[model samples]
Target: AQSVTQLDSQVPVFEEAPVELRCNYSSSVSVYLFWYVQYPNQGLQLLLKYLSGSTLVESINGFEAEFNKSQTSFHLRKPSVHISDTAEYFCAVTSKTSYDTVIFGPGTSLSVIP
Candidate 1:
C-alpha cells in the first residue's frame, strides 16, 4: 500500500514570498507523485506531477516539485506566491500497479496574505 503525508496543515505567507510545502510518502512498490490544489468551493486541480523521466517536474503556474526516490519525498515549492494562490493543497500518490487508485494526504491549507 502507498500513503501520502503532508507535514504542515496550514501555511501562512505574505504575497510574493517563497514557500515550500513538504510531502512525504511510503510505498512498497514504485509510484507516481502528484500535487493538487483546490480553490474555495472548487474541485481539485492538478498542480504538478512526477511520473517518469526527470526527477524534477514543474507546473505552468510557477510551482515545481522534485521527486527524491531515496528520501521518498516530493516537496512542492514556489519562488513567489500570490494572493490568488491561497487554497487547499493535497499531496497524492498512486502505485504503478493501480494508476486509477490514488491516495491523498490530509491536505495543506495555504493562506497567502496581501
Candidate 2:
C-alpha cells in the first residue's frame, strides 16, 4: 500500500514571509506527486505536480516542490506568500497514471497574517 505523510498540521506566517510544509511518502511502485490547495468552502485546486523527468515542479502561484525519490519526500515551499495564500494545502500521490486516483495526507492549514 502507498502512503503520504505531511509533517505539519498547521503553519502560521505573516504576509510576504517564507514557509515550508513538509511531506513524505512510501509506495511500492512508481507514482506521481501533487500538491493541492483549498480555500474556504471550496474544492481543491491543483498546485503542482511531479510526474517524471525534472525532480522539481512549480505552481503558477509562486509555490514549488521537489520530488526526492531517495528520501521519499516532496516538500512544498514558498519564498514569500500573500494573505490570499492562506488555505489548506494537501500533499498527495498516485500510481503512474491519470486514471490512478490520488491519496491525500492530512492537510496542512496555512494562515497568512497581516
Which numbered prediction scores highest in lDDT against the true structure? 1
Question: Lowest summed-lDDT stretch of 10 residues in model 1?
Answer: 93-102
**Residues 20-112, model 2: lDDT tens digits:** 999999999999999999999999999999989999898888999999999999999999999999999999999985577789999999999
Cα RMSD for candidate 2?
Answer: 1.2
Give the clashing pairs for model 2: none
User: What C-alpha lDDT do the candidate models reach, one value each?
Assistant: 0.95, 0.94
Candidate 1 C-alpha lDDT tens digits along 3-103: 89999999999999999999999999999899999999999999999999999999998999999999999999999999999999999999888446999
Query: Model 2, residue 102: what's the lDDT?
Result: 83
Q: Which ranges in model 2 have alpha carbons more than 4 Å from their true place?
A: 97-99
**Per-model TM values vs. the true structure:** 0.97, 0.95
Quickly count the clashes in candidate 1. 0
TM-score of 1: 0.97
- Lowest summed lDDT across 10 adjacent residues in model 2 is found at 94-103
